[model samples]
Target: MKIPITAFEKEPLKDHCGIVAAFSTDDYPFFETGLKGLRILQTRGYDGAGFCAITKFGKTKTYKGIGMVNEVFSDGKRKNFASFPAQQWVYQVRYGTQGIVNDANVQPVLLKHRDGDWFCVAHNGQFAKDRNKREEKLSDTVLFAQELARSREASWDERIVTLLQSKRGAWSLVIATKNGLYLARDPLGIRPLTYGHLIDKKSGELIFCVASETGALEQMGVTDFFEMLPGTIARYNDQGLHILHQDKPHQTALCVFENIYIQHGAGRAHLPRKGNRQINRSPTIDDVRRKSGKILAREAPIKKSDADIIIGVPGTGIEGGMSFARAVNIPYFQAITDIWDEPYEQRTFMSAKISDIYQKVLDHFHFDAASLKDRSVVLVDDSIVRGNITKGLVYLLKKFYNVHAVHLRILCPPIDKPCHLGVNTRSAKELIAARLSGNIEKISKALGANSLAFLSVSGLKEAMYTPKNKNGFCTGCMSGEQYPINEFGEPLAHRRKKATQIFLYDNVTNPAPILL
Candidate 1:
């Protein structure tokens, strides 16, 4: 049956990458310029965004989340000359809060290390906790950042040494200073970061760019390239880009989400696989949409006797409609604006009554009745999470359009499970599919569609992995690969042992690595 799309579909399945951008020479714009670079990462997340730029005065300035970049910077004007087109470095981050959401917690954290200078950082990927006394261990990340500042001699090499000394887990990082910028990923390479460069037309000078996605690099028109291998450090300075691979093994296990939903469809980042032929690394949401579309096209292309017009519900459906149209080779139209397309953008349309639902859906962008007058419309979406939005949209569509029939196509397999990683689906009350109320048809008809077609689990697995290249991904939310609560997230069984002070930062020498 059609997978009704839901808001959580866009959440990054994992903490993927961190974006660092800076103007070393007094040339490019430097006012939270990382924001400008990360604008391309909007598809990665819209919930929050933040950036920090290093200053020559050893002062670090930041403009952080709680709002859009434009909205956050709405009142502040650039007054510091230290950050851009002059003396500075920039780092930006998106996706996942790690439960540390605060202006204090927002990265890139600029602070003094043990050396006499300043260093700033932006990190991606989860840091493995002590598995016991997780909170005590959690405090260590800050202490670790503090310790790095304390132990180092305050130089470019020192910052690298300081970061290197930490036994912390996966992180894709950017550390900046007065002389240059240092970029590195964790030993495990659990996150993704890449760089390419171009010459600026305004100044006719060469520039290096680093970003979380290739789409960001492509926007700047840096076509010529080579990848910064995982576990490598890239430094930008007067001499130019200095690259060094980590002394630690550079083996990579690229986060699979980069292809599934993180990177926009520039599969050119594909890697060498199977036989030595290269494959695209990060796949785009559009790629998934296209495949879902192709699937719908194969399964149920519109027939002449079917409906007068063809319409996709919105967002997810838009692609499926195109797929169905192409598969059936018929006209595809934007039947309505997806109520959740700009899910967060609808906060202003709020009212107190359920009856007001119709008005809210209408107000937030939906249906162009002119084309939807009396045609059988096939609606496609990726998944239906809560069923509230889907139920509302169907009611709104039928009431407004004297449509022939409405068919639903879902690109994703039925979400029979809840996700534990970043998504907050531990509770069954939130998942409509998790209700296990009855048979599949009962669920589809209950949602109010003429017919429902869901991509089978195998189909979803094939569609997601084909064309793009990657091992396997964490599809725990769809197939019950895992339950929401992870035993790993649980603390080490502290009850048996006395509540000893566990320093989760720097070194674990206090207890030693000895087996108790």
Candidate 2:
């Protein structure tokens, strides 16, 4: 079922659905748990949701749909599940933020991890260098998995571990191999992961559950919990779960977007790093909501003290505006629009490096601005990406109303560069802010917003899980800071430094641009 644009993107916040898995000895209602997790993630995704279970029959069963979990699974009641518990399953609600959103692209990208033995996997972050390697090429994940298959001669878990060690950037993934269950995160805690337990009464058996957030575990009556450390693998068995690895001090590359866009705002574990040196810091999901509101209240104070209506653009900024509205004692309002019916997701275009800002903004909404025709309004959104979409929104609002000024409040700071982490941002030409000559103020004016403000970098950091722990993210997009890759496997660098006049492709390559 379609929803309001702001509602579909959950207030236009760039969050994908969370993933959860539970393992036990006997088969149980694993599908039911997956369904519940997808339901929670439905608020985060729209392209679709899916889950896969490894049964005692050793058969893998998958349930997926393009609609909400309830809309898709409403016909199947939980009582119908076979009461076995020792199965491994993975659940995901995709917002089409990364990768492809086609039916074949919906993940837990099933693969025969060990000689035709099937393995199911789901990932939260992208592999920076891996994406570029497949650009303008067909099938990114297939090539990615194929490479993984070639690099190792071990169990699926070992292959995944080795694959991660060899690869770079933000990634937290889980796979269910025939041997057991495989779980691992990046060396730095950019994405959050956690686990808890649920006991079966009939069998007196205990099951271990892993998820992107603690909230998913909480929903399954597994309140007793522990956060999964980065680079750690927790293998589930009849003896409970085993931590095969622990969060370590390596090439730290946590994604700041986890706090700005992804994540469910659970706490994080911080592993601070300076250049290549790693140190411990508080790890917790940052909560940018209230702090952004407080900052907006201070920087861009509204005249008349309160508005007839407070409207958040949706998602991240909605929460901040709600926080701000409550503090100022004003009523919060949401302007509904229709944009969910668009045939494609903006993420699809971006992943291909296609730039179509207006369509994405229009697709993410199903709203009617007549509701705010003459009313006082404030628009809230997470962060500004390229000023194009926000400029289009300003045009749409002004066209429809004898409107008051649009007080635009963005939670995160200006995006100054392409993301070198999991996100797919290419070279310099694509970024609008990067192309600007003067200060950000000039850029905001060009976007046509009457007023605009951003949450501070310190404020964004503080909003995360905590000030210390094991969490840190790679914000290479905002600052051209790199994670320092070794001389090997640097394609873009190889093109610049070594292959100065050489360009190769499929062995029939050219030394320069091969015009089509």
lDDT of each: 0.53, 0.56
Candidate 1, 77-179: lDDT as tens digits = 4344323443455555444435444455555667775556776776655554445444542222344466567664546675565556454444566667766
lDDT per residue as tens, model 2, 1-516? 344333422222334456778787776766776566555555445556677778766687776666555554555544444343437878876554345656765665676643667777776655554433445232234445656656456665567666667765455677776667777776665565667678867668677787776556767767665665566665676565666766545544566766565544443333344421121123333335666566555554555442466666655556677766665666777784444553333243343222344455655655565676776566667766655556656655654454555556666655656544444444445555567642455555666555556655544555543455223545445532333332122423322122111100111111111111
Which model scores highest in lDDT?
2
Model 1 lDDT-worst window of ten: 500-509
Query: What TM-score does candidate 2 reach?
Result: 0.72
Any idea what lDDT model 1 has?
Answer: 0.53
